[model samples]
Target: MKHLILCCLLLCACVAAHAHKPSDSYLNLVVEGQSVTGQWDIALRDLDFAIGLDANGDAAITWGEVRARQSEIDAYAMARLQLQAGGKSCPAAVTEHLIDDHTDGAYVVLRFRALCADTVSELQARYALFFDIDPQHKGLLQLMYQGQSSTAIFSPDKATQQFKLTQPSRIRQFVDYGREGVWHIWIGFDHILFLLALLLPAVVVRREQTWQAVDAFKPALWSVLKIVTAFTLAHSITLTLATLGVISLPSRWVESTIAASVVVAALNNIYPLFRERRWVMAFLFGLIHGFGFASVLTDLGLPKSALVLALVGFNLGVETGQMAIVAVFLPLAFYLRRTTLYRRAILLGGSILIAILAAGWLVERVFDMKFLPF
Candidate 1:
């Protein structure tokens, strides 16, 4: 069982390293009468992965390299998306190509126009970009119709969506953004790992270079509550502030620091630097993690009129998802606390492994390099 657990941890660490930054592309579409015009911003790193934007293989992509392959980029992207109006295809064409920067990295911006045969009341979009190469990639869509906006997330499971070219529904926006928040937390392996590193020792008390399971459940529960509450409060504060544009940080710095925090949190388990006071680590690191969470909302561009509602819904969704994780993890961890597997194999051995994985993530995020196979 211990070996099986170790294997699972190793596999999870490998997978989490690949998921340091979830893959995503942004699309903004406008509908008017019988025409649709929009811009799509896809990460240059993703584009390079799909179509080899770095021609000379110097590990750096230049404008010359991207310019030379404009045609290929157009063909590759446009072919993957199809717009429909009133059940008829509105053949699309790319009008311009440019570069833009998002919180994550540089993006390839494609401005295009699509015309239909008649007036459009309802619009359908088919998006399959990068699904073949990177199944985890998601397309984030923002639609502007009749002076209102709606957003949707497209992935391999749900590649097509329809939008009504009418007044926006605030409820719809709230629900959609909420679901997105939940999805973001679920796939955020780095965030999950960081939280787990903090929680691993919650049910146990550290004493003299070793760990022992607590005698009662109340103390363990209280310990978990403090850690979770601190993390939630910290991230919630920053998530709101960052999403509201009150403050901002570079994505690379935020991501690198988040990874470093994970390294410290996990290493502290083996080293017992903070011993019983893990909540301090959670609150401090969670501030950086909140910035990481804000990337999705920042890229989607929050609704002006419904800013507070959207923010509340997204934050609630994040909390709901986080609580669900704790629900599952707390029980299992409490059960395992009394075992030798938990004290020696998981706490000691697992912390060392998590630290190593987080270290790799730190190197990757800070240096902007891909060392893992995935």
Candidate 2:
């Protein structure tokens, strides 16, 4: 019991740590012969953390403060990025500095130009932004060369990458997007909580107003299959539609509803709603979750040449990630289904905690306020 309590606490801490969207910076670079032009959109919150942006310390950062610190910002940012063209270093300079708003928050946009010694047939970029302080920070890159677009992600482990100025590789794009899909689902706390909330009862049966462990593993496995399949199918539909721009919804509305879904799903675990047909619930909410997933791909901007492949690869990767979570959870949960630790502590207590955390997220997202640090 004591060990179960510790594990639950650790889980809650992990969730809270990643409750908000992970830090990401958008880097769009265009290569034209020996010249390079691009824009880097970095979250102001992240910038403030790296360097003191608030001059007056009133918690509000003004243009005056930002403008005054432009040189520092440029120096700090440029030092982290290096570019090369045709085996020679291409020196970059900040041509413009502006601010823009994203779905999450405001960002500092740095527009820059670089000149190379020779024509750029290939481009090499080394991105180390924010990796020192935050290992989870990712640099989302969109590279354009000779009217062809290619995309890549820069992480702490994979900081430097080279791109050919000719055509993009279909296999590379598929694998990259697939890897990103897995990463996104892993970091997406609301999605994970919603799925877990549904899975918590998969190993047990509701009978006579009480829960009982399943007599055999087959029933539990079947229950998980139905729920996972329903969620996969529903989310795949919306993910495709939303990514293709056939359907759209306001980001705030989508995000708020996603949080609300987590709240409802967690509460249902405690209050006993949709006892036998939780898959139906999974399908309905998964449609909304798909929209949430679309936001990441939409921001990444699919490669025009390999659109279908990238989409399919990413969707398959999501399923792989989701199933990986289930693989670890289902067997252990089944093993402990008959224990008080599983029923009362994990199912009831964990659900209550999830509900409360999600409720906080709902209020924060809807009100556009930050009540929690995450």
lDDT of 2 by residue, 187-302 (tens): 88888888888888898988888778899999999999999999999999999999999999988898999999989988888778898899999999999989988888887878
lDDT of each: 0.84, 0.88
The list of candidate 1 runs beyond 4 A from truth reads 2-15
Of the candidates shown, which would achieve the greatest TM-score relative to the real structure? 2
Candidate 2: residue 284 lDDT (0-100): 97
Please report the TM-score between candidate 1 and the true structure: 0.93
CA-RMSD of model 1? 2.1
lDDT of 1: 0.84
What is the clash count of model 1?
0
Worst 10 residues of 1 by lDDT: 6-15
Write one digit per residue (lDDT tens) for candidate 1, span 240-332.
Answer: 899988999988999999989989998898888887889988998889888988877787667777788788888888888888878877777
